[model samples]
Target chain A: MSHANLLSPPSSIPPKTALSLSQKAPLILAASPTSSLPWPLSLLFSRESPESWTIHENLFLSSLRTGDDKSARLTLDRMTTRFGADNERIIALRGIYEEALANTPAELEKVFQGYEKILREDPTNLSIRKRRVAILKSLGRPADAITALTVLLENSPTDVEAWAELSELYASQGLWAQAIYSLEEVLLVMPNAWSAHAQLATLYYLSTPSNITTLSLSLRYFCRSIELNDTYLRGYYGLKLVSQKLLPLLSDSTSLKRNNDEEEAGPPPKLATVKKLEELATSKLAEIVRQYNAGKTGWTGLDEAEVIAAKALLDHGGIER
Target chain B: MAQPIVQTIHRDPALFWWILLPITVVMVLTGILRHYAMILLQTAPKKQALPQIRQQRSLVRGINLRTHAKVLPPASFQARKAYMVSAYQEGKFLADPESRGKPRPNPMSDPAAMEGMMGMMKGNMAMMVPQTLIMGWINAFFSGFVIMKLPFPLTPQFKSMLQSGVGTRDLDVRWVSSLSWYFLTLFGLQPVYNFILGSNNSATQSTQQMAANPGAGLMGPEQDPDKLFLSESENLEVLEYKWVLEGIEDRLVIKFGL
Candidate 1:
C-alpha cells in the first residue's frame, strides 16, 4: 500500500489500462484560457465559497440568462471600478443607470449628482442641466431651482415654463412687481398666456389700490380666462364675482325703460353681457351643487367664500349683490 | 465665451456647517422642519396661466380684462387668517390649479362642462373618500382638545378678540369645523400634480421656455389665442390652497386638474 510501490506497480500493471489512464488524465487536466481556474478543480470545489468577482460573475451570468439588462449592468458596475467608463460595458451600464434613475428617487438623486459632476467637467451639457432643474424643484429648492431654470431661459426667453416658474416664485413671495415683470416677459415671448393674463387680473385685483379699477382688471382677467377657456372654472368664478360687483350697474340698465334715458341709450350695452354672465353663474352654481351632491367633490381648497358663492347659485337664482 | 456659467462653486464644509446650523435653528424654532413639505407647498407660487386668456378677454369683453378671480373675503384680516388656518387643517382648501389659476374652467356655467366636471369631481372624491374621513376624525379630535384647553384667565384680551369677530359660540366652533373640512383638500394634491406639474410628457420641452427666460411675461409674442384657449390638456400648474382661496368667489367650485 506504500506510495512508491503503487507507482512502481503502474509499470507492472496492464499496458492497455495504463495507456487509457494516461490519455484520460491528460484530457481531463487540460487548462482553459477563459476559465479562472482549472475545470477539474472547479468541479471538485463547486461548493467552495466564492470571491466577490466570482459572485459578481455568477450574478452577471444569471442576469444575462434572464435577459435582465439592468441586473447585468449592475453586476458589471460592481465588477468594474468607476462604472467601466470609456469601456465597452459602459453603454450597457449607462442604459441601466438611466432606467434606474427614472424609477427610484434615490437612484435619480444619484444620477443627478453624477450628471452634475459631469456638468462641472462640461458646462454645455444642456440636457444634464435641464434634468438638474427638474430634480432640484422636485427636491424642493425653488430658489436654487429657479437659478438653474434661468440658465435655460436666458437663451430661450420664449420658454413659457421658465417664465411661469419665475412668476410663480415672485407671486409666492407676494412680490407683485417682480411677478408682473415676469408675466409681462412671458407675454412678450409667447403672447398667448391667457392663464397668465387671468393671473394678472387676479394680481391687479388683489394688489391694486382701488377696488373698482381692481374689480375691472379682475373682470378683465376673468373674461380673458373664460374667453380662453370657456370650459375652465376659474374664468367662470371670476365672471361670477365680477358680474356680482357690476350687478348694480347691469340691473339698473335693465330696469331703465325705453322711455328712460339710460334704456334709450341702445338697451344699455353692458347690461346684456352682465345678464348673460349672471345667468351663467346661476346655472353653473346649480350644476356644481348637483355634481357635488352626486359625489363630485369639486376640489379641496374652498374656504367659506367659495362655498357661499357656490351655495348662492344653488339656492338663489342670480340676484343682484 | 459664455463666461463660464458656473463661475465659482465653493463646496466648503466650513461654509456648509455655518449655513446648516442657522437653518437648523430657524427650522427648529418655527416647527418648519417637521412640516417643511407642507409649508413649501403652501408658500410656493402657483403656475402662471397660459396667454390665450388675455385675447379671450379682448374678444369677449372688447377689453382685455384679466380672467382671474380676486380671492378676497368679507372678513377682517384676523378672521380671514384664522379661517384659512382652520380651513387648511380641515382639508377643505381647494386651490387646485385647474380651477383656481388664470383661464380657469367654469364648471358651473355650461351644462356640458358641468356634467364633465361632475364626473371628474366624483372620481376625485371617490379616490379621497378614505383619506377625507380619516383625516376628518383626527383633526376633529385635536380641534376639540385645542378648544377645550382655552386658557381663559391667562389671556383675557386675546380671548375677547377671538370672541369679538362674531358670537362666542359660533366663533368657538368655527375652528374645529374648519379642521374637519381640511380633510377634503388633502387628497387633491395628487390630481393637481398629475394634471399640472406632470402636464408635459416631454420634460425637456415642457419648460424649455421657462428655463431659458426666467420672469418672461405671460403674453408671448405669438399670442395664439386659439392655442391659448381650448388648448390641449397637456401641462397644468400645481396651485396651493391658500393662494386659490385668497380670491375666491362667493361660491367655490374646485375642479381637480388630473
Candidate 2:
C-alpha cells in the first residue's frame, strides 16, 4: 500500500512523500505520550497505547530517511525515555540512528563495528543482524551482505522477510536461479501472498523467456496472483505481458497437434485459453487505468507510475500485437 | 400437577454483612493481585545460539511445508519433501549434532528444561498460593454458617458440600455453607477478573490448568528435537501433493468471463 493514500494529506507533494512525512514529525512528537516525568506523574498524564510507540518509531525512520536528523534524534530520545535504552527494538533504532548520521566510509565502518560488538554479545539479535546486512549493502559490499543474509537464513529458515530480501540481493547480482529459489521459499511459507506470486512471475519473466515451461509457469503464477487479489496492478500487468508474448507462438500451432508429452511437469496452457486470458487482461488493464485516473476516493492509492505505464502498454499494444 | 413445597432458611443478617460480602470482596481482590503478579513474574525469552535457532526453525519449516505444500507443483513438492526427509533423518539440523540417535536427557538434568519448568512453577505458585490462603482463611474464621441461598434448585448430591460444617443430613440442599461459597467464588470469579483486567488476563484458573500440562506448547523441551524432526519428516514424506494452480487457466477465463 502507498503511504500517500493513508496519509492523504491535501498538500500535493507527489514526488517527495518522505519530506512531507518528516515535516509531520514535530506535530507527532508534541502530541505523543510523555515519559519524561517520574513514574506516578507520567502514569497520571500518559495516554500511551501500543500504536503510539509504533507511530513514534515510524516517524523516527521517516525523519532519518529525509535527513531530518534533529527531529530523528528528538523522536529517538523520547522513545528511549519511554522504553529504556536497553530495550531490543530501541537498540536497533539506535543502530539505524548511528548509520544515518555517518557521513564517510570510515564512520560507517565504525558503526558497522558497533553492530558487530552488539552481535558478538548477543548473536541471536535478529534485528541487529539484519541491520548489519543493510549496512554492508550500503557500504558497497553486496557479496558480504549476501553471506550475512545466508547466515541469518541458516538460523531462521522460516523468516519470510529475510527470504524476500535474499531474493532481491540475488536478483541484483543476476543469480536468477537462487533468486527464484528464495522466492519459492517465501511462497512456501505464505501460500496466499499475492505480492510474492506477482514477484515470482516478474522474476520468471526476467530470468528466461525461451524456456517453454517458464512461459506457462509465469502465466499460471500471474493468474494465481490476480486470483488472490483481483485489483493487484502488477498481476494484471504481468498477465498482459505474458499473453502478449504467447500470442504469436500460439497462433501458428493450429496445424501441429497439442502435445500431451509432458507428464510430470504440468501441461502447457491451450492457445484458445491463452487468447481469452490476453483479452481479459487487456480489458482489465484498461478498466484499472480508467478507474485509477478518475481520482475516485478508493482508487487514489494506485501507483501513479504504474497506472501511467499500464496506459502506455495498452496504447502500444493496439499498434503492434 | 402437584406443586413441590419450597423450603426456606432464615439466617442472621449479620452473616451477609461480615462473612459473605468479605469473602466475595477478598476473592475479587486476590484475582486482581494474581493478574499483576503474573505480569511481574513473566521472563522475556532468552536468546539462543545460531545452531539452536536453526534446530528450532528447521522443524517449523518442515511442518509449514507439510501443511502448505498444496500450493506448490508436484515436482517441486517432491523435490522439497525428498530433501527435507533426508536432512531430518541425517540429523543435519540438530542443535547438538553429537547427540544424534541418543535418548533425550532427563528433564531434571537439563538446565533449559529446568528453566521452562521453573517458569511453569512460578505460575503455579501464583495460582496455588492465593488459593490455599483463601481456602484456609474461610475455613478458619467463617465455618459452620449458612450465609446465602441459591435462587435455583440443586440436586441432593450437593448436600455433602453445601452443608459440610453444619453436620445436618436433613437440611435442604438450597442452604449453602461458607466453605461451599468459597469454592463457588473460587471457580466462578473468572468473569469478574475478565472485567477488571482484560479478557486475556492470566488470573483465569482455566489457563493455569492448561499451562500445567506437560505438552502444552509446540516444541517445548518436553519433546526432543530429533524425534520431532523425524516424525515431521515422516509426515511430510507421506503428504499427498496437489497443486493450487491445477487448471487455473480455465478458472481465470471463467472468472473474467472471456
Candidate 3:
C-alpha cells in the first residue's frame, strides 16, 4: 500500500477542527483526590470520562516505571475515536503513541496514522511538525524530516525551537554551510542569542575547508556574541581562535594600520567596541587566568582565546609565576 | 549484380559535425553508448516503491538538531545558522520528489545517448553533485563542528533548562567529563558508515531494517515488543517523560549510526 494511504487509514477517525485550549482549562483545574499528587498529576487523574481519558492515560502512564504497551494502546484508541475530532487527545496521546511504536512491533505505522490524523487537522501546528520530524529522523528519513522543518519554518519563522532542532539535524548530517546559515537565521530573529554565534564560529572553524574570509566573519560573530553576553565563554574562545590568524596581523604594522583604517571606515560605535575589547582582553586576562587555574579542567576548543590571553598575561608578568 | 545502396542525397558534412560529433563525444563520455537508441528512448523514471512518510514531529526535531540547529533556542549565531540551513534544506527536500525519484535512463548505455545525456547532464550534475556531496559531508562534519564551536562554552541561556548552576554545575562540563570521549568515538561511526556504505544505499537499508525490526534500533536487548505497544497506548506520561528519551537515543543510533 502507498505510504500516504497507509497513514490515512480507513478507520472511522473523526476529522479534527480547532483544538480548544480554553475549553479544557476547567478540566485542567480539577484536582485529584490525593493531596500528595502534583497539580499536573491531579489534573490528569481527576476523571474517567472520555473528556478526561487523555488525562487518565497520562496518570496511568506516570505509574508505569517500565513501558505499559497495552494500556497505552487502549488509551490511544479511546482518545482517537471517542474524543472530539478537534481535541488535544491525539496530541496528548502522542507520547504514548511514540512509546508503543518503539516497543511494539505490529503497531509501527498505526502510530503514524494517529500523527497523520493530527497533521491533517492542523497542518500549521509547529508542535505537530516537530513530532513528525522526530518520527522521520527515527525512521532514518532525514531528507523528509528536512522537508517538514522547512515547511514549518516557511509558515512560522519565529519558531526558535524548531529552528534549533533543524540545525542539530543538519549538523548530524555534516551540512556545515547549511548549519552555519541556520544559526545565523536564529540570530536574526533573536539577536541576543550568544550560543548561535558561538556555534557558527565552530562550524566555520571545524567544517568549512580553510576559507580565511569565512573564518574572519566567524570571529566577528563571536565578538558580537561576547558583546551581547559577556559571560559567554564560547565567544571569548572564538576570539582566541581568530587571534591565531590575527597574531601575524597584530605584529604587522601594515595589516594593523589597514585594520585600523577598515575600522575607521565603519560606524564609529563598532570601532569603539573593538578598542573596548582590546582593553578588556588586556586587563581581564588576569581574572581569566585565575579562573583557569582555579578550575581543574584545563580548556576546550572554545577556550583558545582565553588561553592566548593568559599566555600574554604570563609573558608580561601580570600573574605571579 | 545488386547496386550498392550509397545514396549521396543526404551528404551534409556540416550537419554531421554539428549533430553527430557532439553526440558521439557525449555517448563515449557517459559510458552507456552501447544500448539501443529505441530502448533509451523508451526509458522513464521509476517511482519509488519506498514508503512516503510525512515528517513526524520527533523526527523533524531530531533532523533539526542533527543538521541545522546544533544548539538549542536562546543560543546565539548557532541558532540563526540553524534556522537558515533548515530553511534552505527544507526547501530543497520539499522539491518535487517525483523529479528527484525519476531515474534518468542510463546515458552511458548508448554512445549517442551517452554523449547527449552527458552534455546536458554535466551542467546540472556539475552544479548538483558537489552541492549534494557537500551537503552529506556537512552532516558528517557537524557533530565535531558543534562540539568544537560551542562545547558548552558558557551556561548557554538554555542551559538552565538542560541542567543548571553557575561555577561547577555546568552541564557541558559534566557532559564532557562523561560523554566527550563517547561522543568523539560515536561521532565518527556515522561518517565511516556513510563512507563505506554510501548514503544512498545505507539510508535505505537502515530504514528497511527499522521497519522490519521496529525494536532493533531500540536501546535495550530484552525489550518485549508486545509490552512496548501496550505501554505506548495505555500510559502516555511515562512514555513522554521516560521512554521517549530512550526511544530517541535508540533511533538516532540506528538511523544515523551514531
Interface RMSD of each: 16.0, 1.3, 16.1
Off by over 4 Å in 3: A1-86, A89-101, A104-110, A207-209, A245-321, B1-258
Q: Which stretches of candidate 2 lie above 4 Å from their native place?
A: A1-28, A31-46, A252-265, A318-321, B1-12, B73-75, B211-217
- B1-258: candidate 3 lDDT, tens digit per residue: 996353223334553454334333432322221112222333332222112112222223333333433233223323433443444334332323343334544545746446544544433444345435533543343222112123334545544332221233423432221123222322334444445333422221232233322323431223332233233233321222211111221232233222
Worst 10 residues of 1 chain A by lDDT: A1-10
Q: For residues A117-228, could you state the per-residue lDDT of candidate 2 as single tens digits?
A: 9989888889999999999999999999999999999899999989999999999998987898899899989999999998988887778874446777888899999999
Candidate 1 residue-wise lDDT, A186-297, digit = tens: 5544445566667776675556543443454466556556555555555566567666766675466444444433211112235555556656755765665556446544
Tens-digit lDDT track for model 2 on B145-169? 9888888878999888777777887
Query: Share of real contacts kept by model 2?
Result: 0.90
Off by over 4 Å in 1: A1-115, A121-127, A135-140, A184-196, A245-279, A288-321, B1-258
Cα deviation at B133, candidate 1, in Å, is 79
Error of 1 at B246 (Å): 27
Docking quality of model 3: it rates as: incorrect
DockQ for candidate 3, C-alpha atoms: 0.01
Q: Of the candidates numbered 2 and 3, which has the greater lDDT value?
A: 2
